[model samples]
Target: MGKRGGSSTKGWAQEPIGALRVGTVGPIADFDPDSTPGFDGDRRLGEELLTERGEVLAGLQELLFANGRAGDHRSVLLVLQGMDTAGKGGIVRHVGGLLDPQGLSVKGFGKPSPEELSHDFLWRIRKALPPAGRIGIFDRSHYEDVLPVRVHSLVPQSEWEARYDIINRFEHELVDTGTTIVKCALVVSKDEQKTRLAERLDRPDKYWKYNPGDLDERAYWDDYREAYQAIFDRCDSDASPWYMIPANRKWFSRLAICELLIDALSGLDLHWPAAEFDVDAEKKRLAALPD
Candidate 1:
């Protein structure tokens, strides 16, 4: 793995998350989607670690929500971008399951509605941003404007090409406004995606998960790869760096995301909000009214 910015090993014991950060310039094609980076543990250990970290994660999340109630502007935004069946849903279900839903906002961005198309590309995105003291998760994000739009030629070459700088400026503004952005590009092997898609067809319970259009997208795998590589090259920044997550192994991807969330929250250095009323006075009043 190549690293360009600062190390992400702060507050971690096992391995540095910095290993997963994309370098200044590289081919996304070189990263192995099946390999677990910055982690030495297997599935069993991953599950155990995830369980052990839940308490800390839960506490930090509560502190974040509490701070929000106390008028803090700090928040965290997790952006997940990947191919279909790259386990973005799994990250939401398992990793996000650790925190209180009251403080977590998960949004899935699909094809735009007619109304959305009438406005600028980021019009809908700005509406979904997580507020203060919340951990917002974007299933797919503004990067779609550059990725799919560029690959499919949905817009003119000059228009989509200009979005790179536009996105960078937009993200810088988010960071400036006390939002810590953790952008993750989940990398899944083409073969693994095929198998996962086939499994969805094999099981009746997964029928709804299958999309006929997924095959259409798969045909443009190489094109999408080039697009993603372009994103890594252009959109990566120090204030809001992109983490390339290996998603072939569902367990590892879930575990890695959980750790990343922990790191993000921990960096905030939050604490329980102080009570506005006097503690002793409140206690005395409660005692007098006890049944």
Candidate 2:
């Protein structure tokens, strides 16, 4: 919703310029996966910009962590959802790597365990939430209940259908309790996915990243697309809107996500907590101590 650009000469902008909030843009199908929406730079420039912003990102994260330690009740949750090979891991590594690990919580949700399935969908999600002043990341999240389950017919129609409202309410509750949610759907082109998948198979080093079952899921690509569209339609709200990230270019996606994190952290307007002890008294006490 703001101006699209690489970076500001001053500092990180309060609103990310790279990607638009879901509703402000047209249907997901119309957007180009390869296009860099708000960026005018090439890959080299994107990389440099990301490097430049890393310092700011780290400082902001420290402010957040400090506030939490000082008893602030605010935090941020970044939810990343996308097709296989859409670069979720890359975002976590490149962007998440920039911040202090102590201030960040990353959780990847695979197929639910039996124990997880026994509880309400949000139960596990609730447990994984970032504590006050930390950033929590969901590699895949509650939307999985609605997306994969709906696409594969893993649950009854009515049961999965109801989760849309359930998720909306859950997010609303999170916001009311001082959590800022940043939900990003990383969209990659099918052709690019095929290329990436093939590369994984061709490289012995990357074999561990591949699964035969990924091919099975690829057959249902269209169905999954429909499911994701439903998610954007239903769960997107003012309190926690979705950001559709075009992830065909891994470098661009990584940079855009970094910008989004900057926007989220800077928007909080956090300040360094004041020292509880009297500074002058503490200084005098330190001065009086034998070196």
Candidate 3:
């Protein structure tokens, strides 16, 4: 919607040059998974920045929550889509961990259960939406319908192919009804994924985190890549744009996500809700009470 480059906006963080933002159609291969846009600092600097921004984000989130409770009736939705072990969990813990749990809703979409599969693809997503005045995080979101469903041919070509329009319309409806959607694709290189997966087996403490099935899916990396390319092509929009974040560096990935969210929430123009009750009268009443 705005200029496609590395520059600061009045209320939002500056996107770095080469950051892949889907608007019309473009090749995903142009974006390097190792590139850290807008952040040229090392991991140590990334950590410091994340900490500083985390505090600011917490305050903004509080304002958003207060405004919602005071009947503003708007919310923020962070839709995270990525291949397995792409640092989605780390982003959730590091960035989302800053917010008050009362105003946070985190949902992970895995393989649809029998009950979920029976309904429309977006049924669970719609149900899991963050209420007005809160932030919602989707560990993996409705995009799965387009990605794996197409990659694995779980649905007919005609069916999954048509989902792009469905998703676009669905996001537009959400925007109309007062939800701001920020979708991020954590881009981790295949080599990095292999390293992480191997470390999982090498360390006993990380055994539970290791999934044998992930290896099976690794075989379909190219398929998943193509699937993601299609998603960026079809679903990226001004209302709900997709951001491809280079996640090979976990610290940088976390910082970028926080920056994205901070930028989104900052644009909400949130304010602390005014007190509905008479402050002076309440103060007088309390002062007159016996201690």
Candidate 4:
């Protein structure tokens, strides 16, 4: 695809996660929902750009998969957290669809089941981790424990507050075991969210996706904002830093996430594995087989 306004590949890969990260200081209030951050392209062109980059994206995923198949025990986990209608599903459908399905795992976490609630919050998360040879995407993740739980008072403040340290340690353990975690928060403005929710209500095809409770949650927008600030303050870390993606524009959001994934994979030395057996001998053996 033709270049957009974003940083160069060389620069992006080397840039610290803090460049687009939110931590300690809460920038949500002052941050622009429509900010494109190194990208100036509009939705119309951004869609075409994503199409253009598809091949390269697939190729990079293949290299990562090949590395895993060749016995490299590393894998990638993309954790997507955002407000409702912020396009988590779109990321899975667009950006994630570029990868080989055989090597892709997507887990959508909803309300905890009775069984899930019985264990630690991370219990279900651990079960959803991708194997060494695949890419895993979480539609919503463990951060839900901190966000909605904290906002709705599902857990006491002391307990949810304590989860920050527990979560950091859990992520550290995951990294120590060869998982690279990429966390993204798709940020949309209150107005933008209202527009999206309205669209869902107005369209017959989208009616099934609408939930009355979304309105209830919207009432607590400020509360959730504060909860998110808390998450950024305590959870953003070197091992798994969070990228705040301005998602007012769906096309740009998808493109930005695609570029982010490409950059993350580029850091790894990925290559096609050399054949273990003699290629000529293997070819001859196959050639001699009966049709």
Full ranking by lDDT: 2, 1, 3, 4
lDDT tens digits, residue span 256-279, model 3: 778778778877877678898999
Stretches of candidate 3 above 4 Å error?
1-20, 23-26
Q: Please report the TM-score between candidate 4 and the true structure.
A: 0.90
RMSD of 1: 4.3
**Per-residue alpha-carbon lDDT of model 4 for 51-157, expressed as tens digits?**
76666677777777887889988888999999999899999999988888988999999999999999999999999999996889999999999999999989888
Which candidate's TM-score is highest? 2
- Candidate 3 global TM-score: 0.92
Model 4, residue 6: displacement in angstroms?
A: 12
Better of 3 and 4 by lDDT: 3
Q: How accurate is candidate 4 locally (lDDT)?
A: 0.81
Judging by TM-score, tell me the better candidate of 1 and 2: 2
Q: Write the per-residue lDDT of candidate 1 for residues 1-291, one digit (tens) a residue.
A: 011212234333444357678882246888998877767767888788778776667777888889999999999999999999998998888888988999999999999999999999999999999999999999999999998899999999999999999999999999999998999999999999999999999999999999999999998999999999899889888789888888898877877777777778777777777898899998999999959
Q: Which residue pairs clash in candidate 3?
A: none
For candidate 4, the C-alpha RMSD (Å) to the true structure equals 3.6
Which candidate achieves the best lDDT against the true structure?
A: 2
**Regions more than 4 Å wrong, model 4:** 1-19, 23-26, 287-291
